[model samples]
Target: MTSTAKTPLPPAACATALDPTAEPFYLQVLQALDAAGVPYVVGGAFALAGLTGVERPTKDLDLFVRRADFDRLDAVLGDAGLRSELTFPHWLGKVYKGAFFIDFIFASANGLNPVDDGWFERAGRATILGHPVRTMSAEDMLWSKAFIMERERYDGADVAHVLRGCGAALDWHHLMDRAGPHWRVLLSHLVLFGYVYPDERDRIPAWVMHELLRKLHDEMLAPPPASGRIQGTLLSREQYLADLRHGAGDARLKPAGTMSAEEIAAWTAAIGEPHEK
Candidate 1:
């Protein structure tokens, strides 16, 4: 098998933080999707929090769907008056609606998209803005984050936060097995993020994270070949750091806009209850 070299983290990742408005938008999207009965699981940064417990606000909503349901998704969003900008069948697999964008991902871009199998099986339920929804399992979120680390795209903090939040709850064996050949890269990311301090490295349980790192170091010295085309959206370490610095105080970080009295009254007459207040 051809092995791919990992790219070093870019400087911009620490510079461009996600807009603080992303959280409310996320809630809005979830409500809209749930109301429409569209099956989706939150992924990417927002989903990462469910796994790692890192609480940085995300810039966009990342939702994954079965390939068979793509057309249905298109129809649903179209009816909602949301426009889509398709970016796949080329490099980046993405779909955008106004200020919101969702990355269309298959399970394995190189082989088969194994996204649907057991997707809900690995999800846990949570309430967002009084709406009930299912999210990715903490372990699965870690697996997804670990895979991203292999590509050398984002900061170790993302992974660090995951480790801190769900380390005790993670299934080390399952995580190792799912990480496949890219285990060491993930471990190095954890170390870089200060999640695994040098002095405390030995103390990390001999379970999944530690063993996976050790095995990858001893066995897979040659890395996997980069599969998907590298998207420019990948953030560098510097950008990630910068974002962390400024993201906390972003002005857009506030409660979502409440509907005006007229709008609320119209919605109450139309939907029979107050949807937004």
Candidate 2:
């Protein structure tokens, strides 16, 4: 039950939730990107609210771009009187105007799914702050959020809302392929989706459940691999620190994963201590 229909944009009233002073900067950033012809899709709270009709206040905006566009954005933002930094070399960068900023994401923190051409191919047309723009596809948004299971921030609920909201409109096949070698993570989220929305269980295609279950069965029967890979780290770097210290390889590290050792150390160091703002 996949679809190509564009999601309705969240109401302009939602913009009122942002800091009043920052609103102008937000609009300027959008206008700057359009003027510069830098292709990007609106994501983060904007996409979540668009797909699920659930609005939440957010200080930061998210724009998904290809890796190369991020490099170009460095100059684009600067020329527009804005500044930005590559917050995480592997996945994210932030554009700043005073204390308010927008995130330009090119990949996931775990280094699994990087933004690529396929993302734009599936993106939907939308308008925000009086500027025409693309919206992150439901499938791509779900793929990114599925891996965000940090102790401070778990997105399983967000994943379930997307499933409930998109229903048959979701491109299940594309999502499955996007999951690739990490299909189990997708399967687990699907299981939880059903648990969260009992009456809407049938929203998921029967064949998907059947296929994933069959794969799970095969996985269960297979012999454990000789290598000790702790996939929990892929879900949350901080939560799995104990495992790494106790002698287990992180699935997010090189030779076994997509990220580098230096990148992992830097990411771990950036984790802020849990506290009230």
Candidate 3:
């Protein structure tokens, strides 16, 4: 069960823009979630804005709802005359209201991390769409954003800004645990963050740096994971299909996640690339 502290928004005010004068589509969805008692933590641009005060134009609202509550959200949105779909059963769903959409996220696209009860405990409250809503924690957001290094969309800068803006407020130890086996990704971002803002280098904890460096040193001396599969394809499905196809006969080749061959082929085709011959 999630928590809500803010009072309900008036139907008329639900449509109000972020300016609170004009109703926005995203708010309407938020209002519906409130009515249905669905526990959600707002993320993406809105959460980023609330957490870091760096606002950017967003195409849609991102709401992280627990997997169990998704059906509840689906029914609530339907009753509110909205259309929705579970685009990826493993990780995401979408609620459509006219031209606007809400990305209902349950887990990371890479299938590595999930939004569990711990996320709710760490969420911070903020006023979004004229209603108070839980915002994702900096640590959770950083973990979620770390793997979004697709060809067209890279969120490294966003990660750096969160590091810069949140500073000591971010939970370094939790983030390190969240990164887990993927600690190298975290180290790369930290290195870039130091490069992006030289003055803020000290903002990141010294032990975190030492720990990551230690992991790197240990990795350099150790053999790679037993699986001969080239996992780099996990970084970007579209960009790495060639690597996967070329190694099709190699026993070491394996998909990094749950993405099915059909799904991968469809995804590649959507980007206008021909299916592997």
**Best-matching candidate per TM-score:** 2
**What lDDT does model 2 reach?**
0.82
The alpha-carbon lDDT assigned to residue 36 of candidate 3 equals: 78
Candidate 1's residue-wise lDDT over 1-277, tens digit each? 3323222221112112356555555555566566777687766665665454445655555666665556666666666665554333211234454566656553422222256656777787655545666676666565555434223244455666656555555566666666554555556655664445453333234454557666867666876545322221122212233343543222111222222334323322432222110
lDDT of 3 by residue, 1-277 (tens): 3322232111111121243322366778888888878999988877777666667666666788888888888899888888988876656788876556678888876455778998899998877645898888888888888877787778898788788777577778788888877898899999999899786677777888999999999999998777656556545656666766776322212355555655455444656332111
Instruction: Give the distance in Å from residue 173's predicted Cα in candidate 2 to where it truly belongs.
Output: 1.0
**For each candidate, what is the lDDT?**
0.49, 0.82, 0.72
Task: Give the clash total for candidate 1.
Answer: 18
* Best-fitting candidate, scored by lDDT: 2
Model 2 C-alpha RMSD vs. true structure (Å) is 3.9
Residues 18-116, candidate 2, lDDT per residue (tens digit)? 667787898898888888888888888877777777778877778998888987888988988888998888888888877788888889888889898
Each candidate structure's TM-score, on Cα atoms with residue i matched to residue i, is 0.57, 0.91, 0.83
